[model samples]
Target: MHIWDVTNGARFSTYAIRADEGSGIISLNGGAARHVQVGDLIIVAAFASMSEAEAETFKPNLVYVDGSNTITHTNHSIPTQAA
Candidate 1:
């Protein structure tokens, strides 16, 4: 997975997820955690390579959460951005 630090304009940094005793914790460790401050806006994105045909048929499951990190909803598509 790649973590993009949106607040600091940093490029993606590779990372491995570790299972924590306290579930539902989103944290950055090691060198990547050096520059990130608490409450920074970061995006964790994952990707998989597949054939073009497979890609066209792929629909990612998007999950939505509330401020408390509770899942509010989920769907396969996101609404279009307003013009």
Candidate 2:
């Protein structure tokens, strides 16, 4: 997974997912905090791998979230791989 910082346009690749939360909110820790700060806007993306045949037929789900990280809308689209 990768976390993209909205402020300075920084990208942090992380594998750790924190389970603890405060005020019913999940917070970033470790290396994620070094690139991300409090009240900073960020986009977290996770990817799944499949067989080549599955990839040819697989459709990815795109989630549109609001400022508070609430899912406002979603749609399915084919995944694109960069060269």
Candidate 3:
């Protein structure tokens, strides 16, 4: 998973999601956590690769989430809010 802090414009590629959900909590154990905090809106994206040009042009699946990190929406296209 790719973890990005939208609030601070910081990106991390090695965040470990150590726990499954129940309490709607997100934890980061190392120095990366310093870039984020409570109430920060972030993007957690899962991705795949394609070798074909047509396949490469296609958008990846995205799960738009909120402050609590709960997914609020999903789509094949990147959301306009990202820009």
Every model's TM-score:
0.71, 0.71, 0.60
Give the Å error, residue 17, model 2: 2.7
Over 1-83, each residue of candidate 3 has an lDDT whose tens digit, in order, gives 67888888989876556676645677766887787887777777666666798686887777666656667888887547654
Please give the CA lDDT of all the candidate structures.
0.73, 0.74, 0.73
Q: Model 2: per-residue lDDT, tens digit, 1-83?
A: 88888888999788855654432344677767788777777777788888999988887788776656666888897467999
Candidate 1 global lDDT = 0.73
Error of 2 at 59 (Å): 1.1
Model 2 residue runs over 4 Å out of place are 16-26, 78-83
Using lDDT as the measure, which candidate wins?
Answer: 2
lDDT of 2: 0.74
Q: In model 1, which regions exceed 4 Å deviation?
A: 20-22
Q: What is the lDDT of residue 50 in candidate 2?
A: 89
Which pairs of residues clash in candidate 3, taking residues 3 or more apart in a chain or in different chains? none
How far off is residue 74 in model 3, in Å? 1.4
Q: C-alpha displacement of 58 in model 1, angstroms?
A: 0.4
lDDT of 1 by residue, 2-57 (tens): 77777897766676677564365677778878867777777666778999999899
TM-score of 1: 0.71
